[model samples]
Target: MNTPDTHSPVLEVQSRRRPLAWLVAIALVVLAIDLGSKMWALAELADREPVRLLGGALYLSFARNTGAAFSLGSGYTLVLTLISVTVVGVIIRFASKLRSLPWGVSLGLILGGATGNLVDRFFRDPGFLRGAVIDFFSLFDPYGQVWPIFNVADMALVTGVALAVLLELTGRRIDGTRAVKERKTAGPGTRDKAEQA
Candidate 1:
């Protein structure tokens, strides 16, 4: 008996590194952008002055947050610091499993955001592990409402979350698009099928 040809496209589809490499590349790019922007913001808004870049509605106001999202839980810089460190550690440890761009980007955003705030806690005024994160962007409403100030790091975190959600909803596989469809084709409740796909 003769075996089937193994060089055909279908048989050759299982081996590929393009997706993994692309994911890593995108992650690095985002990390660089996040870090660079934060550095620039720190220098440009040194005196905690608000820079009105577009007049009334949008402004770049320098401030600091020593808490979690939306400035909640203030005075917990140590807690926040520990959480950030844990997140970074976890991402680095499991990076090999982040097989898609969205996963990689999410981790990258998280890592960069963590580093950004970590920088403040380590070097900003009030000494090590007690500094507040610098936030500079604000949205003003015509109805007299103001949004919380945020920095580049916050933006990355939000964007990454949004993308991850989108990818998950679309049934996009972490390994690749082919893997996603393959799993679906194998039907539900099949553990082996899911794993191989």
Candidate 2:
């Protein structure tokens, strides 16, 4: 009884609920993989010197960042935790509004990344809400740490935000609707009269 036609329109049913579930699934997966990698890094590379890879362009160095990405807000662990909580909350709110596939992908990445970092912020080290994030991957050493060491979650966050920015520039909304700009038009008679006169 199954046919190709039966499987065709699977992507057509763009309900918000399904996409929201997708978002949650992505978040859980990202959180799991990110945390798992961090654990592996801590166990394997915590005490070792940075291991060069790709001819020293990339290296594995265990770092504990108590602040925002690249240790920017070192003195604001609690504040960053609060901001991350807010990021998670905002993404959850947006999940229920997703109807477009692009929106779903972008929001899912954001949600996943935010949750991944939040887990570290809440349970990694020093104390609650003051724990440091585990960063291990460093890139472009010849460039003098120009890239600022980051983790998988940070990469996801940056990618997601970039996609969102592109979507906004393309006049697409999160609800699967296009923001078409209306242009002014003149009546046929008026246009003709003006031309003729």
lDDT of 2 by residue, 4-25 (tens): 4522466445465676667777
Clashes of each: 0, 0
Best model per TM-score: 2
- Candidate 2 wrong stretches, greater than 4 Å: 1-14, 142-144, 187-197
Model 2: per-residue Cα lDDT at residue 165: 98
TM-score of candidate 1 versus the correct structure, residues matched by position: 0.70
Measured on C-alpha atoms, candidate 2 has an lDDT of: 0.77
Backbone clash tally (model 1): 0
Give residue 67's lDDT in candidate 2 (0 to 100). Answer: 71
Model 1 deviation from the true structure expressed as Cα RMSD, one decimal place: 5.5
- Pairs clashing in candidate 2? none
Model 2, clash count?
0
Model 2: per-residue Cα lDDT at residue 44? 97
